[model samples]
Structures are given as C-alpha cells and as structure tokens.
Target: MSKQRVLTHIDAAGRPVMVDVSGKAVTARQALAECRVRFPADVAAQLRKSGLRSAKGGIVDAAVIAGTMAVKRTHDLIPFCHPLPIDGIRIAIDWHGERELRIDCMVKTTHRTGVEMEALTGATVAALTVYDMCKALSHAIVIGPAKLVGKRGGKRDVGRVV
Candidate 1:
C-alpha cells in the first residue's frame, strides 16, 4: 500500500475537517508541553524578593490553577476540537535562572485522541498568566514559543523535541 497521507483532518480538496475517532481504542494518553517567559532584570529581582505573594494569591499558585483550568477547557476554547474527559492535568512553573521562568504542563486521558493540544494550551496559558501578572513590573516581559515536548498513545508515540 502507498504511504497514507496525514490528511485525515483534511478532505481531498484540502479543506479543514475534524477527524472521526469513534473507532479508535480508548487508552491512556499523556502529553507534555513547555513554554518560557523572560523578565527584565529589575522585574525578576522584584519578584524574587517579594516571595510568592503579589496581590494575586501567590503567583505560582494562581498560574497552576489557571493552567489546569485551561487544559480541561481546551476543547471549548479551540473550535473543532473534540471534548475529552481529562483524567489528570498538572502544571509546574519554575524559575529558570534569575531572568526567565519555565512553565510545563502535563495532561493525561484515556480517550480516542491524544492530549497534546491540552498540554500545549495549558503551558501557553500559564505563560500568559505569568506575563499578565508581571506586566505591572515591566512591559519588557517576553513570552517565548510553546512546544510539545513529548506524547504517547494514538497510532504512534512522538518523542521528538522542537
């Protein structure tokens, strides 16, 4: 058989289409995504000095909650996405050196499709939340690109990093 094209989500005319996963098996799927945010030296120093409190109920705590909520509602936010019952979602935010912050989101589900989107959405939103909170300190905040670090389940597991 000729190599099958990766156009399941597109029609012969190349228009966007949602793939039908009704026949796929329900198996545990997991995905990890990450994003980074850079802060000005002064802003980073201020944040580190203030500890976790910043009139927003602990910056890291709020980010984790926001990221988890985003993961669960990824389908609602993105059109044409199938809503899946998420088994678990975790968001971890950490200081990368003194001028950058890293956000990582891990999503787990037993569903027909993988949860890579959920992980990506979670990480991106968390990074945005950080930017929003720190913008008061400096408009120089920069949110970097978000990428899927790893995924498992579905037709084949993907371990490539971008």
Candidate 2:
C-alpha cells in the first residue's frame, strides 16, 4: 500500500480516526468566533426599534439559545469529533453599525481537545438563526464571513484581529 499523509485527527494510517487525547493533560480551553449579518437600512431601523423581535420571540434570544445548543452538539454534527463535556457557552449579539449585526460565541471546556469547533459552530448557527428571523423583512439580508476571533489552550493560543 502507498504511504499516505496522516490527518491531524487520524492515526498513522489514512483511515478515518478520532484523535486520542487520553494522554493529554486536561486544561481550561476557550475559543471565540464571530459572524456578521448585513441587513438593509429599513430592516436595520426596524430591528433597532423592535429590538430584533418576531412573533416567535426575541431574535437575539433565540439565536443565543440556538448557538448554545449547537456548541453542545458540535461533536455529533461533525465527523471525526470526540464528544466533549463543555463547561460553558455564551453567545452575544450586537449591532455593529447601521446595517451590520455582529454575533460572537465563546465556548469553554477543560478537556483534552480545544473547543474551537464548538465556538465556530455556535457563531455560525447564531448567524443562521438571525438570517431566518429576518428573512421575512427582505431577501437582501446577507450573512458573511464567520471567523475565529481568538483561542486559548493546547499547544498555542490565538488572538483576534488587531
């Protein structure tokens, strides 16, 4: 058999594998991710006035709940992920500007693997929830460019864009 590159979460062979983190010491790990939603001026104005609410509930509140749920279930949704016991999850939504809404998710765990995936999933799902809530207002609403803002633990720590 031809030699193959070992994936980060895979074993020596090329076959799919979950990372063995048993030997790694448990440590506090945290990650933050962000996504931005762009809405039309009119929609933005309405949101500001109504505090981003629909008949269902508050848009931000629903998104926060969705984001937290996503964080807990990220391992189940993503392949090659080891189910983890998360310590905490927080989702924050705020207006970045007249037409932009910013969503941030922070995930915490003291485990072998970092919670980067959880944070990313939380942020993305929150943005999606926002899109769903505002779709009735206009199809022009755009969800853009989710990214990791910061991470700490493991071999390295990352900081946000300066």
Candidate 3:
C-alpha cells in the first residue's frame, strides 16, 4: 500500500503550522522559479525601440537586482519560511517574445529546508518591478503564472533536472 502524502505545514490538531526542520540534516539546496510579464503590443514596440530601457533606466537590469534582494529577504516576507543564509542568488530576465518578458530566479543554500519559497518570491517581485516601471506606458500589462520550475535537496527533488 502507498502512504498518503500529508501536508507538511499543518499540525496534528489540523491547525496551520510551520514545519520543524531542526532535526533534518543540512544539505546543499537549490530552487528555480519563474514569472512572465506580457505587455501591450505598442508598449513592447516602444521598449524594443529604446533598447529595452525606459525613463527609469534599464528594465531587465533593475529586475535582476530587485529579484536578488527578494531572494535574500524571503523569510521576512513569508511568515512560515525559515531564515537561511543564501549562498548564492542569480536572476535572469529575458524576452520570450516581442511582448513577453520572462523572469527566472535561482537560489542556493545549505540548509535543512528547501529554498523554493525564496526563488518564487524573487521571481514574483521581479515581475512586479517590471510592471511598476512600465505602468506609465500602459495599464494593460499582465503578470504571472509565477511558479516553481525546479527544486533540489531535502527529501526529494522536483520539476526539471536538478
């Protein structure tokens, strides 16, 4: 018989609770998350014409910096996330199409818990930063499906090749 997968963030009393990782062994962990921003066609044309820059400055460059900061501060933003020393964080922003911007955030740590939340937060915030910077051009920008694309270490690895 297969065992049922129990929710890790819940207590025996059925209350929401943070998972305890104190007894778990520390190991190298990495997670990758992504978000996509879709801008209006005219806005994209203007951005490309400007070499992907806006009056505020380079859009992709600013997103990378904001994503890195989000990775380091994830625990502060999410109540259940454990504070871990991030060994490294890399954020890449690229164009998926003429009107779509893709943001990927990768985070690494040596900790008992995985850094999936950190990676997700990083990507989401970076996408938000892009929207904030480009709002002046149009209010029709769309952001997300923000998601964890990969994760490694802890009990199991998930998504793409680790």
Candidate 4:
C-alpha cells in the first residue's frame, strides 16, 4: 500500500496539533494570494462611472484596510495558525475586466513559519469586504476562487497562475 502523506497538523495519535516551528530558523518569507469579485455588467458600469465608490464609501480603499487587518489577525481566525510579526502587507484591488475586480494581497515577514495562510486570509477578506460594500447595488455579486498564487522561503517555493 502506498504511504499516506503526513499532515503537519496531525500527529501519530491522529490528533490535531499545531505544527512545531520552534526549531526552525527565522527567515524572510513572503506569500501572494488573490481573489476575484464579479459584478453584474450594469452594476460594473455604474461602479466605473462612480469611481468605484459605493454609498458607504470608497470600495477599494475599505477593502485594502480590511485586508491588512485580516493579515494581522489570521492566527486568531484560523485555529492552527501561528501568530507571527508581520513585516509588511500590500493589498491591491483592480479591475480584471468590465465585470470583475481582482484583489491581490502580498504579505512579508521574518518568522519561523510560512505566511501563506495570512496572505490567503487577507485576499479572501478583502474580496468579502468589497462584496459587502457593493451589495446595495445588487445581491448577485460573486466572490470566489481565492487562492495562494505564490510562496517563498519555506521548505518549498511554489508559483501557480490560477
């Protein structure tokens, strides 16, 4: 039989456990994550004309702040995440096409563990925030396909275009 891939969060006893990183050396690590928000065509046109503003306020600006906050609090949100000092976080929100907005979040830190979760959390929360702010325009807005695009300085470095 083929061996099962060991999960970092599971121990021999098959109990959940946080991965121990105490013995690992601190290194500069970074991760990039992205998510997309799709709006109805007419709604997208209205937003473009309004400079991407909602009745609440600036949609992209609010999402940026929300994403930054989510990066810092990722450990709190995900039970297995280890809290690390965030060195930097950059969030960008832009149009992918006439009807879709793309949000990318890049996070950097010097820590024993990787920051993929933090990056993914930031991007996911940012997309959610955009949907929340624009729901007044229409409830058909879709947020999805959030994923880590790249990670560096871990046991491995991976890059995926999706």
Candidate 5:
C-alpha cells in the first residue's frame, strides 16, 4: 500500500489553481537555493587574469544584484507563488573551483507560505545574468542544477546552512 500525494496546484477537476494560504499561520520561513556556472577552460583562465570582469563590468557583482532583485519579484514570474514581503535575502556568488562559480541565494520571510520558490528563482536568475554578461567570452559557458538546498519554518523543515 502507498499513500497518494496530491498536487497542491491542481484542483479535483485537474485545472490549475493557486494554493490557498489564507488559513495557514504566518511564521518565519527561510529557504536556500544554489546554482552553478561553469566556464570553459580557456574562458576561465581569461576571467581569472582579468579579475572576473567582462566588458559589461563586474561579473560577480552583477549576479549578486540580479539575484537579490529576482528574490523580491519571484511572485511576478511564478504563477503559484504569493507576493511576499521579504524580510532578508543574501545572494553569494563565489568561485567553487578554477572554472566554476557557485551562486547561493538565501531568502527569509514571515508569511503563510514558504519561500523556496523565491530562493530558487533568485539563484537561477543570477546564473542567467552571469551567462548573459559572459556570452561574449564563450558560448560554451554552462549554467545548471539550479536547486533548492534547504528550507525551514514551514510544515516541514529541511536542511541547514553550514
């Protein structure tokens, strides 16, 4: 025997519907999401020598700014997400290795719904911004595995920042 899991965004008739959060208690919630941007070997070397700046300007700085903005506007972009007043957000873009950049977005809020989507949106948008700014450097640049790393203060709490 197995328990059947119901989709929150779908009604019994199967039409798409937003989840109702009005009855849910408002609480402090946080989510952490991550993404990675990997540059080709040659491009990575060039970036290092030039201090991670493209002709467009500082790559890391731009990603951070874009990610933060995305966190706030997540509701506008995603259909099911509720517009939330963000309590705090931190976007960190750093070198994971010689050729890879890691982007982490942590979002916090006091709301009825969790902020996992917001964090994920922030990290992924930041990665896209990185790719956009560096496209001239190389079309082979890769962005991938945008994922929710952790979340807390909801029906189910999971993971933690170490």
Candidate 6:
C-alpha cells in the first residue's frame, strides 16, 4: 500500500490555514510553471503577419511584464502562500505550434518554503493577459493546461524543467 498524503494547509479541525514554515530550514529553491494560449486559426495567421502586435501593443512583451509582476505578488493573491524574497523571475512566451503560444515562468528564492505557487500564478496570469489583450480579435481564444513543470527544495524536488 502507498502512504497517505497529508495536506499541509489544513488544521486538525479541517479549517483552511496557511502551512507553517517557521521551523523548516531555509534553502535555495526554484520552480517552473507553464500555461498555453491557443488562438483561433485566422487570428494566428494575422498575429504572425503582424509580428505579434495588436491594437493594445506587443502581445509577448505585455505577457512577460504581467507574469513577472504576478510572480512577485503571489503571496498577496493566494491565501496560503508565504511572502518570499524572490531571487529571480523569468517569463518566456513563444509559439508552440501553428496556433498555440506557450508561456513559461520560472521563480527562484532562498527561503523556508518552495516557490511552485509563484511560478504557477505567474504563468497563468501571463496567459490570461494575452487573452485579454487579444479578445478584440476573436472570442474563440482558449487558455489552459496550466501546470507546474518542475520545482526544487522543500520536502523533495519535483519534476525538472527548470
């Protein structure tokens, strides 16, 4: 039989609570997360022809800026996240195929807790920003499959993309 996994953000009474990291050893940690935005077929062609610019501005640049900002404020957005003094944040946006754009966010910090949440939040927000900027072009755009590509530190290291 496998071991039962315990949730760290709940008390014995099952009330939602932030996980305590005060007693944990401080360590250098990092995480990478990704989200994708899929444009409609016609929209992709137009975007490519226009060098990824829209009426709002440069689509990729706006996403990168929004993603970096979100990474720094993840604690304020998420109920259980600890405020981390981030060491670095990187957001990359690029075409994955013919009609889909991929966003990757990587966060680094030296702290008692991990930064996977920060990475996830950043990537997701970035993808959303893209959708918002391009909504005028089409309402058929889709964003999804957000996931943690990798993380390091805490109880154990997970995945490996970063």
Q: Which candidate is the best by TM-score?
A: 6
* Residue 90 in model 3: lDDT: 87
Q: Write the per-residue lDDT of candidate 2 for residues 1-162, one digit (tens) a residue.
A: 976754686556666777778899899889999999999999999989997897667999989999999999998899977788999888889999899999999988999889888898999999999999889888999997899999998878999621
Off by over 4 Å in 3: none
Candidate 1, 28: how far from true, in Å? Answer: 0.7
- Per-residue alpha-carbon lDDT of model 4 for 55-106, expressed as tens digits? 9999999999999999999999999999999999999999998999999999
Tens digit per residue, CA lDDT, model 1, 1-162: 887667567788999888889999999999999999998898888898998457655888878888999998999998767899999888888898999999989999999999999999999999888877777778999998799999998888888532
lDDT on C-alpha atoms for all candidate structures: 0.87, 0.88, 0.91, 0.94, 0.92, 0.94
Model 3 lDDT-worst window of ten = 153-162
Better of 1 and 6 by TM-score: 6
lDDT of 6: 0.94
Candidate 6 segments whose C-alpha is farther than 4 A from its true place: none
The candidate, 2 or 6, that scores higher on TM-score is 6
Span of 10 residues, lowest total lDDT, candidate 4: 153-162
RMSD of 6: 0.9
Q: What is the lDDT of candidate 1?
A: 0.87
> What stretches of model 5 exceed 4 Å from their correct place?
1-3
- Please give, for residues 4-120, the per-residue lDDT of candidate 5 as tens digits: 888999999999999999999999999999999999999999988989899999988998899999999999999888999999999988889899999999999999999999999
| Cα RMSD to the true fold for all candidates | 2.4, 4.0, 1.2, 2.2, 1.3, 0.9
> TM-scores for all candidates?
0.91, 0.89, 0.96, 0.95, 0.96, 0.97
On TM-score, the stronger of 1 and 3 is: 3
Error of 3 at 91 (Å): 0.5
lDDT of 1 at 87: 95
Worst 10 residues of 6 by lDDT: 153-162
Name the candidate, 3 or 6, with the larger TM-score value. Answer: 6
Kindly provide the TM-score of model 5 when superposed on the true structure, using C-alpha atoms.
0.96
